[model samples]
Target: MTEPAQEPPFLQDPYAPYAAMRSACPVQSKPVDSGGRPGCLVIGYAEAREALADARLSKDTAAFFDGRGSRRRLHPAVSRSMLASDPPRHTRLRKLVTRAFTTGAVAELRPFIARVTDELLERWSPGERFDFVAGLAVPLPVIVICELLGVPESDRADVRRWSAALFSAGEPDVVDSASYSMAGYMTDLITDKRLHPGDSLLDRLIAARSGDERLSEDELVSLAVLLLVAGHETTTHFLGNAVLALLQHPDALGRLRENPDEIPAALDELLRFDPPVSTATFRFSTEALTLGGVEIPAGVPVQVALGAANRDPERFPAPDLLDLDRDATSHVAFGHGIHRCVGAPLARAEGEIALRAVLHRFPGIRLAVPPERLEWRRTRLVRGLASLPVLA
Candidate 1:
């Protein structure tokens, strides 16, 4: 008898699986890793929050791999970026990058973001069907991040291809290839910026690399790749997920249409309802610890399920329902503690501008196909639609 292949748990209704896991234990043992080391998944809100900030749960993935004597190879830039470093190094890298994403810096981008939103929305014809993800959600952030990072307009297509491949969890070879290509490209970009400095963020980074507060060549290249990829990828998925949520809940959509001013304030709730990043990047346990009352052996990997924690009934009453009126500011959508996403301010600005423009221009926009028919990306870290078909 032929047996049916089962859909991946993440591709299905992930909430039910999350709830099932949470019910069993907030922190549960996961299947063994490729190196035969056991791991744990943290699903409870309190536990996840604690896990994110726990110094014992290290983010130094390169060190972890080296200690395990694993033969797997990763680009030095990819493995050594701020995203994977701990304390002293993480602090230095974060401080340098944080300068570009300050409050005033992000606010300065509002006019540019609005201009791009209007330009992108101009293509939608009345009563016409189009893939919203392709048309707006994907390109808007990509364009914005590219412009911010001084990536030439001509090279954005290749940049997007390389960035997308970096997240292909099911394909290690593709990820490695993308990492090498992106690192090489970033190295060249840094050299060009050094030769011909400009006002772009990359130029500032290059200046820092050359100045007293120095950055190694590897650090400079890695930071550029991280900013380029992280800056857009999360926002892209966030816009797609936010739009889908609004479309599914027409009442909320109508409310936003009637009161566009509320859109910005409502973004937190949208983020909490269906966060873009499903699980945070992997963190390794540096020592034996008790998380959510479960004993975690030293050196095991820990994954905090941000999506699950955001919807924890213990923290959020009526977790399943999307209530824009609710105060969702505390959601771990951007993650928590020292390693929180540095690009959140820019992402929120982009989302607010993009969402407002979409609703204003295409108030009549509706899904072209059933919600269930929409396929999600197979990546483990992010939650986003492959394509959001809509009639405008």
Candidate 2:
């Protein structure tokens, strides 16, 4: 007897099927890699959340390259980056950057963030129309990164391109070229930073010490690159995606517009509705372990689908509906466990202020094009509108 062919793998607009998949197989078994062993898909809210915090699953790539499977890099140029490592190395690397992004530490940067938001809004004038993703979401993070890293504003465009390419999902050859270019550019920047130390995040990290524990040369470079990439990419989508969601649902927008104080909750709802990072940072299986009933063997890669888990009915009522007043927690938009984004508070602060400003600054703001016709990111990693053409 033939097991029925699973529906054509869901495409860009796939929130619905994920719910169905979760309903059918909370823990689903899918082929691993090309022809390797089978891996499991964790779709339940609690199950996904549990796996994120599980110590058994490792982010380190050594096992992936080890005898457990082939040695080919899975994520292109990102293989050696921090997101690919686990344990003491991850622990050490995270520590250096974490201090710079500590909760209250990020709070101190709000005024500057507000100022940047104000300046960016000023560029739009009174009745101009522009691509929100390109004009605002993209640059806002670039500027914030320069400020955080102590890099001069003059070099941000180049840095933005570098970080974008490095994290972007594309063919291996293209990604490899971008990785090489970004690495070369970073090496130059690091040299310059060494020569002229400035009052920037780079300087802080370079000088960071925990009783003589300092970031290694590779650690510094990787962290710096990671900062630029992680600092902006996810937040870029958060703002653009949030506004996109609001514009699509006028009542939700109106509710948020009226309450104004509900922006935080609104942001949370936006994250769940259309999270920036559709999939959680990749984690590799340690041993044959069962998640949500399926047995995922050791040395297999498993991903927690944030987009799916965010909408799991068991965790969120009416998972597909966007509620402006939703008390939206339990969201994995920011990955869980020790890897929970250290810059989350800052990212949240930026999104709330940037998005609310767009609404408050232009109450008449509306999408210039039909939602269906607008473009979206092709990659499954970052779920965001490509160019949200809006009239303000």
Best by lDDT: 1
| Cα error of candidate 1 at position 305, Å | 0.6
Clashing pairs in 1: none
Candidate 1 on 101-220: residue-level lDDT in tens?
888999999999999899888887878998889999999999999999999999999998988888886687888889899999999988888888899988888877344359888888
Span of ten consecutive residues with least summed lDDT in model 1: 1-10
Superposed by TM-score, candidate 1 places the C-alpha of residue 101 at a distance from the truth, in angstroms, of 1.0
For residues 20-111, write the lDDT of model 2, one tens digit per residue: 78878887776545565566677788998889888889887645656565644433325666777887778777776777776688788888
Alpha-carbon shift of residue 64 in model 2 (angstroms): 1.8
Instruction: Report residue 292 deviation for candidate 2 (angstroms).
Output: 0.4
Top TM-score: which candidate number? 1
